[model samples]
Target: MVTLRNAGLSLTPRNIDTQSLSLISWNTDGFSSRPVSRASLILDHILEGPKSPDIIFLQEVTPFVRAFLLKDARVRAAFLATDAEDQTGLFEDVPFLTMTLVSSERFADSLHSQKQGQGVQGGEDCMLGRVARVTLPSKYKRDALCVDVVSPTAPGAFFRLINVHLDSLGDTLHYRAQQIEILANVLHEPGCSGGIIAGDFNAISPEDDGLIDKNGLVDA
Candidate 1:
C-alpha cells in the first residue's frame, strides 16, 4: 500500500504523462441540495483541462444529479448508489439510464452496487453509494461495488477505487478513526491493488487534534 504523506513533497501536480490512466476523485456533499449545479461546474473544470481522466470517483452525490449526467452523451459511464428512501423506485432509475449509455459500448463489463442501510428514517433513502462491474470479480467480493479498472493503454496494470463518505456528525474523532479502519481492512483484503480511497472524510486538518491514524492517508 502507498501512503501519501502530508509533508515532504512540493505542492506541484505530479507528472502523469508516464501513467496510462488518471483517476479523479472527490466528495460532492450531496445533501447540500445543489448537486445538479455543482456537478455541472465540476464537469466544466474537468473538461477545461488539456487531458481528460479515465475514471471519476464522486461521493455524496444524489440520485438526481447522477441521472442528469447520464442523460448527456458525453458521460462515458457512471456508477452510483440508490437512495433507499426513494420507495417510489425513482432513485434506481438514474443508474439504469446510465447503464444504457455506458454498458454496451464502453464499460462493457463494469459493475455497480450500494452499501446496505438507509440514510433517512424511511427505507427510501441510502447514505452510501457504490457501483462495480455488472459481473462479479473472482476474489474478495462483497455487496459493495468492487471492480477492477484495467487501463486501455496498459493491459497488465489496474487499480481498485473505493468511494466512501464516513459519518459526518457526532464524535468526529471516533468516526474518522472507524472510517480509517474500515478503509484499511478493505484495502488489505485479497485481490485488492493500489487505489485511492476518496470521499468526504470531514477532517479539516492533519493536525486537527481529533484525526485518527490508519494507513496510507495524507491529510491535505
Candidate 2:
C-alpha cells in the first residue's frame, strides 16, 4: 500500500522571481528493477548531485524499482501509479509496465494514483479499448500520478503536479486522444486551479490541443 505524509513542499514561484522548482522525467528502462550501471547514471546526474531537480518524474519504473526509490530520503513525495500489482516480480512484461511517476522535494509528502478508463495505460488497453468509453477494454494498468504542494513563492497557495506515461508502441493516435480526454477531465475538476502535467507522450503535438487549449493549460 502507498502512504501519504502530512508534510508540505516549499516551492519557488515562476512569477516575480526565478523559479526555484524544476522538473525532470526519464524512462529508466527498468533501472530500479535491474539496479545496474545505467541506474548509476540517474544517481550521478540527479540523485547524488547537489543540483538536483525539485520535482522528478520517472517512467518505466518496475514495482521493485519504485519500492526502492520510496526508501530514499531525497524523494519528498512520490505518486507511483503502476500496472496491476504483482507481488511476485516474476513476470517481466514491458508493455504491461510502461510507466509510473515519483515525486520528491527530497523526502515525502504524499503520493496518489491518478485515474484510468478515461485515461491511458501504456497501449495494450488502447488497442482493445472502449467504443466511446461504453465498455472498458483489457488493461495493462498504466497510470498518471498527482501530487499537491504549497510554494514558499506564494505561501498558502496550493498547486497540483501531474505525471503521465502514454502508450509505448501501438495505435497511439486514437489511444492518446482518449487518454488526453481523461487527463483533461482531471485538470478541469473543481478546485484544480493550475498544475504541471509532464511525462512520456508517445503521440505528436496536434493530439495535445484538448489537453492544452480546451483545458486552459499552456505548454511550459
Candidate 3:
C-alpha cells in the first residue's frame, strides 16, 4: 500500500496489482461552494502520483469543478447527475458535475436494462458513469453507467460498477432508506448480477451499540 498525506488528510492507496480492477469513491463536501484554493488543493492531491484510478465515484461537485478536472488528460472519462439543485432557490447556478459524466456513451450502456426515472422523493437527483480505454459492446448496455472490464489473468469473469449518492438533509432518512431498497431490488433482478456500488452514503458511523445515530448527535 502507498500512503500520501496532504492538508491534514492521509490517503492510503492499496497496491492491488495492475491486473486487478479497482474503483474509488469519495464525497467532496458540496463542491459548488468550495473555493478555488481548496479545489486546487484537492486537484493536486488527486494528480500527485504515478497512479491513476480506473473508476472514480465523486459526489457534491459543481459543473465548473467537473470541467476543471476533465481538463486533465489523465481523467479519461467522467459522469454526473442532476441532484445538486436545491428546492429553496439557492445554488441555482452550480453545475452538477457527476450528472454530466453519466451522459457519456461508456457509462450509459451499462444501465440500459434498468428503468429510467426522474428524481425520487427524498433522493438527490442521482446518476452513474464509467470510463475505460476500450469500448464496451452494445448488448451489455444499461441506463446506468456500466462498463466492461476484463482482467487478462481472469478472462471470463466480468463486473459492473455503479455510483450512487443517496439523500442527505433533514427528514431524508426515510427517502435514503427507500432508495437503498430499490437499489437492492435492481441488483437482484435477472441480468443485473454482481457489481460494486460506490459513492457518498452521507451516513454517520454507528455508535457503540452498533446503532445508527438517527438524531445526528452523540451523547456528551
CA-lDDT, candidates in order = 0.42, 0.45, 0.38
Evaluate candidate 2 by giving its C-alpha RMSD to the native, one decimal.
11.3
Which segments of candidate 1 are over 4 A away from where they belong?
Answer: 2-19, 77-108, 112-145, 150-158, 205-213, 216-220
TM-score-better candidate, 2 vs 3? 2
| lDDT value, candidate 3, whole model | 0.38
lDDT against true structure, model 1: 0.42
Cα misplacement distance, residue 193 of candidate 1 (Å): 3.4
TM-score of each: 0.56, 0.57, 0.51
lDDT, model 2, position 70 = 50
Ranking by TM-score: 2, 1, 3
Tens digits of lDDT, candidate 3, 92-150:
54334232233232233332232343111111211232232111122211122333232
- TM-score, cand. 2: 0.57
Off by over 4 Å in 2: 1-19, 31-36, 71-139, 151-157, 204-211
Model 2: ten consecutive residues of lowest lDDT: 125-134
lDDT of 1 by residue, 68-108 (tens): 66565566433322232232543343221111111222243
lDDT of candidate 2 over 1-220, digit per residue (tens) = 0111111233443321443455666666763445544544664576565555555666666555555655544442333333323335423444323333333233232233223323222211111111011111123445566554443344333345666666545545566666656666665555444556676665455554454555445554
> Can you list the residue pairs that collide in candidate 2?
74-106, 75-107, 76-104, 76-105, 76-106, 76-107, 76-108, 77-103, 122-167
Selected candidate, larger TM-score, 1 vs 2: 2
State which candidate has the highest lDDT: 2
